[model samples]
Target: MGQHTILLAEDDPDHQALILRAIEETGIPCRIDVVENGSELIDYLFAPPQSDDREGGGTPELILLDLGMPEMDGFQVLQVLRRVRDDGRSVLAPVVILTASDNADHAREAYRLGANSYVPKPTGFAELTEAVARIVKYWLVTNHGPPADRSDPQYPGVQSI
Candidate 1:
């Protein structure tokens, strides 16, 4: 199985349901852990919930983020995560912003703030399913996301980004 497990941080129950269903349809075997808010996403990623509650091996490979959450939104979580990485506390992970907002400015800000990709949430179920499947095939199968320091120099289209 691919080591790229997905961590989805979303608040909307209906949207979360649909996203989980789409992810399952993608046929990827990676675990998909769902969190209701961005704060929980941070806890699950960096700090285990509780030693007894979380016996998972390690952190997730990718984050499917929602920008507008209740208390701590995706951007705030991204900022904290970046800070942690900058401090050499942990390796950075790819964060893909998946939200209903179509604001171009928002997308630009997300990219500026360390988001690897900003995909507008598809409205229809079929389209969303295809998008999720394509995302899995690309990120989990084709693409490689790693920390900036250890990348091979010969790898084209790769950068410390």
Candidate 2:
């Protein structure tokens, strides 16, 4: 597959570094973008047309979102994304919540809010590396995502429902 884009919305700098290292270790050919807070993530995703960032950071194939964040928070981000998706503007990518919270209620609520997957934050670098490797293996390598090449008629464009 061609190089894909992955967006990670996380607050903790240390955790972000760890995840970035882990993703690099996975050796996936992807351009990973990092956002510090939910508001920044929103801006990254919904940048207005003609904005400078719009041309460069195209839609990510997958999103790794932290549930707890400053400003809007991940759940609120998900809610906004759901609404934006419903508006039929763009096909919102799959969002996976990578959080330290092990609360079942949070997981349930995340799923209710349209989180594609929820994973508890790893406690150590080894565990995080493993988690990120698995995520890359499954989502980036094994999974079949939307076809960006519009010339192929057999591949229907991904639609948000």
The candidate maximizing lDDT is 2
Q: How accurate is candidate 2 locally (lDDT)?
A: 0.79
Clashes of 2: 0
What TM-score, computed on C-alpha atoms, does each candidate reach?
0.84, 0.85
> For residues 1-161, could you state the per-residue lDDT of candidate 2 as single tens digits?
47878899999998989999898888888889899899888777665434454345566788899999988899999898887767875566678899999899999999998888899988877998899889877887787765443342222223333
Model 1 clashing residue pairs (backbone) = none
Residue-wise C-alpha lDDT for candidate 1, range 1-161, written one tens digit per residue: 34456888999999888888888877777777788888888777655345555444355667889999998998898788777767666665578898999899999889888788899888888998887777767766777776434343232112234
List the lowest-lDDT window of 10 residues for candidate 2: 152-161
Q: Model 1 misses residue 155 by how many Å?
A: 30
* Cα shift from native, residue 24, model 1 (Å): 0.9
